[model samples]
Target chain A: MSVTTPTGFRAAGVTAGLKASGRPDVALVVNDGPSHAAAAVFTANRVEAAPVTWSRVAVADGRLDAVILNSGGANACTGPEGFADTHATAEHVAGALGVSSGDVLVCSTGLIGERLDMPVLLGGVDAAVAALSDTGGPDAATAIMTTDTVAKEVLVEGDGWCIGGMAKGAGMLAPSLATMLVVLTTDAALTAPELERALREACRLSFDRLDSDGCMSTNDTVALLSSGAASAQVDEAQFTDALTRACRDLAMQLLADAEGSHHDITIEVVGAATEDDALSVGRAVARNNLFKCAVFGGDPNWGRILAAVGTTDAAFDPRTLDVSINGVQVCRAMGVGDDRSGVDLSGRTVHVLVELHAGSEAATVWTNDLTHDYVHENSAYST
Target chain B: MSVTTPTGFRAAGVTAGLKASGRPDVALVVNDGPSHAAAAVFTANRVEAAPVTWSRVAVADGRLDAVILNSGGANACTGPEGFADTHATAEHVAGALGVSSGDVLVCSTGLIGERLDMPVLLGGVDAAVAALSDTGGPDAATAIMTTDTVAKEVLVEGDGWCIGGMAKGAGMLAPSLATMLVVLTTDAALTAPELERALREACRLSFDRLDSDGCMSTNDTVALLSSGAASAQVDEAQFTDALTRACRDLAMQLLADAEGSHHDITIEVVGAATEDDALSVGRAVARNNLFKCAVFGGDPNWGRILAAVGTTDAAFDPRTLDVSINGVQVCRAMGVGDDRSGVDLSGRTVHVLVELHAGSEAATVWTNDLTHDYVHENSAYST
Candidate 1:
């Protein structure tokens, strides 16, 4: 429930009228500790947002004291004006915190390629600075939101360290890391290089493979900030466990809030020749719009799974592939076998199990069913 | 206008009441005589429909005498029962035509993983045979359609050889080719080997690069049957041109009928390092649902285009990328360098011009916008 409960930092979320809905617009979380180690992963999209640009620069330093997140304006393709707004925000936040502007990270989520309302955003920045408190973690967790049904914040209490984070994504998600924006706070003591390495590993397994509809975004970012408040150095095992749990929990929340999503689907690829192959096959199925539509219809169309898998170069004999939908084996040896009447489509949750008959390692990722709401929400917006 | 206008064939179509919509569901096209040669391509999906399996084997011999197509049932996941249905239909058609069963090609389009309603299909097969006539081309075109607003049949008078074909793909279309069933008839006298070589070359540039939503299907087939009716032995150049034009026109029609399409989009990539680079970059943009949504909303959101193109492996300096939307230069040298005031998205058609500036090869592909109609149509049916 608390963003600070899992780690060594304080966060504050405040509403400053940036959004007409009167939701929180500004969130500031500071790592107040003996360690300033951090790592971050940014969107691979060429059209980067201003905040992503700022975060990329900050993450290069391998350390961060604070992250300033604002919703209601994506600060994306607004040309030079967008960059100026980001710089001005960092300056204002740094002035208030009495810290270097260069050390202050920034991220924004909302409409893409739009100019931020400097008057409103700057006002939110002032209010955020004024409202910052050691116990404002919950508010900060809810501040950076855009069309999300609820604030996505996760807290994990580890044996030797703590990890907490918040995420925002209701649309525009796919590999190459779509519009997902996250800020992870931890109390574990580590250097910038270490944070970068660990964050990439976490993202590779957790975020990078999370595909919704294969549309890459211009403002996808995931940042890690550590305060070293725990003081004790947590070993790599505990650190990864905490990071994994926090990311996993947050990732699911993102899936749950996907635009126009009904059924939260999970595809588990088992018995693959390699983890990459498993992921490749799984991602292929996840991105297939026709398959997702079938899931939305609750048709239990498992043939689409094999059809999607066949398009990949992953090593597997199609005829040797086996597929099960919600515990019912709909296909065997890469071809349709038994009557799918055994499978029940009444359930809201759809699960696809694929066996490659190659090796042991498996991978699973979550996504939501594609519905008219997704198309409506996305198409309704002019950009 | 005529399926047999291409080279050396005759065709027919008939209504057999297999479709609940009371539409035509049986079609047949046959080569006249002269030891006709042929080459064909089948869907890459592993979960092929029963007819796909049958026709792949039939066309594997590099010769085709007749092709039978139905629109009501896919005969996809009926297991052995489905194969039995395909075999029964093929055998019946071959018997009526006085030809070997292996020489008959087949295609089915409808819902996936469902039985072919064997009795109804067989009745339709018999009716199709009875309806066969030298000039029944339009009826044949009408018989092989499902959810299509109009039947897609083309007739082209070539220099030395004429080419005509009918294609059906209202949805489930992408590069690897999903559920796109096409049958071409030509009267040119050519060897099966030469036809094979020309068809592959034509397909790579025409059908292979077309992407709607990037989802491949399990029921795609494109078979070119030669009747050896023409006395002149045409060279490969003329054959390739006519073949490419026919396939390209069909591909365009498919894109125009894309499920839930509001706008027909053309992605033109020029100055790419290689044709592959051009295609990869073009596909990345063409498959982006957000861009499709934006196009539907009539917003010339160039940022989305840049974001999509940037995620590709095509070698290009993202900083040096140039984009022109509707001939209005928006981005230059990887940055916004010109006025975007000239962008007009008020029309139902859009053109996204991308310049990699890497080299001198250009490619154009047609796609449609992602709309609520598309989601509704695709998800509403179990197929």
Candidate 2:
């Protein structure tokens, strides 16, 4: 009941013989609604996947009857042939559901530069459509796994309506979205414009702040579909809040299950001149591989943090900056403060707070420690 | 006979007890010059090391009598105490040579945010001064090693004069100067201004282009000292060419021995609207950890390369871009082309060429493949 936990929605997951592991690889979510209101966000990368290109046009009219996603062989860099494959997949889904082809969005993930196995994929689509049920949300969430260790699902109930979402990503996760595939379902009576506004706001504060590996994917996509079948008229602020909470919850799941990560680290940057400054500073620190490795080693090396911070253009004089690891103020006034030996990083969760002493704005960036296993996993991945 | 390959220079390397391994950790190079003309470049990082701050001021007059460098402690983020330590070390060198303290430059590398051991450091300075000899260049190069597996040294003769240099860096190497310490000596008769222009031009094409790990160190410094002993007023172009060759040689050496790197990768971006655009594109691909890891796995993953190139503001149409690995044009016209299986990556060198199809400019960035050894070395370093 993940996606269909809300009224007037159904989802299904089925094996598509796309993943080498023989796991479920095809997922579908549908809306039987009096109103079809939708919004979507895609990867900012210019070299986008064929599915992303198709879905961008499909969801342009702010209505989507269904979304078909597959886990293997991202149709990216496959030229004209890739786009044709996406179109064909959407057409098949439309024919099965008796909906217009233009109202069906297709999403594909996995290895880039390869075309999908159309026969296997189309067969899985038929099975998914047949298996679609109100309790199929968890299965749909499991179908999109690449390197993800676990399925990610979230539900946030508003005053009278609810929003449910499922996300899948483990690596190639960065701001502006990760190598992720997400689908959201809601029963709130809102227009497409309202859903779009709420989605942008929700992602700006949630998915847009995670920079796990600083690698953007070509197949990143997030879509929202509202059925309005519950007849629950929700206010804009309340809907936005619920969406943000759902996205944030899924984002945390992505962080917690990042491949080969030994520790989940949160960098909270405060006293920034602006929110962008805070985000920029946090991202610089988040992408610093050396700092991530130090954290993986459980070494409270605040100097690495300062070195990373100094690389950013954020407002703050080097002499006035401060850094605290866990609860220990390891560095103050940009110099050695309390003894670092007192800081214990034996836990899996690490919190780093950086004070810029420039303004009142603040932001947090979530990331994972770079570990030897991460190097090993990634080094042997495609080979 | 590295730095001393050119006339009128003496150097020495001595153990300072600063390194736990008891290896040589102190180096000194003195310009026994009839003409004290010099040029230098330091790290662009705002949070510079104490030695970098001190050396900047010392080299401002364009005349340096000697340069002293140490390993085992970076002497950065130690605040006033660290700066004072750098000053004291310079004064000790100045006193030993009877030169002005203002003319003595200093450089240090190793762990950051730690104060140097003044007693052992000063003792090593005395020994270095006592042991200085024209043939001590090789030792001086060896003493500067941090994680470097081999000492980098090069000699190139121009006209009647000659230039010789040494460099040390195994990680944290990037543009705006690699995380390195380099000392160059020449016997050419040139003024400070001329040397400055030539040095900057040479470095801009060599050391300033390598982005090994995309981590900038706070203690990077490169210096060139002329003794005017050979009195060879060679053509400026000839001198610049020789200097650039020497610098490039050392840069390659640094790249070959990068920490835990199994492959020396070169990313060449061509057909950009401007040289800067080409450089921006190349640097983006070079710094992409996922692309680097893919290369380590011997995977011809051109999509990762394109994804990284898209992050840059370089002029290029996504649909017209092309990527080639080794001699195989795996991606043509932004789509799949030749069979990637034809590409052989069994060698230690990997070349990735990207054709932007935007204009007539091109640039190359050298990097290293990301591997588990790199993660292990860095993660266990500070701890």
Candidate closest to the true structure, highest DockQ: 2
Cα lDDT, model 1, residue A379 = 68
Indicate the DockQ of the complex predicted as candidate 1. 0.53
Worst 10 residues of 1 chain A by lDDT: A1-10
lDDT of 2 at A147: 85
Where does candidate 2 stray beyond 4 Å?
A: none
lDDT of each structure?
0.80, 0.91
Model 2 Cα lDDT, one tens digit per residue, A1-383? 37888888989999989988899999999998977999999999988989999999999999999999999888899999889999999999999999998999899988888778999999999999999998889999999888888899999988788998999999888988866998999999899999999999999999999999999989899999999987767899989988999999999999999889989999999999999999998998899888898888888888888888888888888888889999899888877888888888899999999999999999999999998778777766665
Model 1 segments more than 4 A misplaced: A6-8, A16-22, A78-85, A176-178, A191-194, A231-233, A335-348, B6-8, B77-81, B159-161, B332-342
Give fnat for candidate 1: 0.54
lDDT (tens digit, per residue) of candidate 1 on B107-148: 888876667677787787787777777777888888888878
Error of 2 at A83 (Å): 0.3
- Candidate 2 CAPRI classification by DockQ: medium
Candidate 1 has an lDDT of 0.80
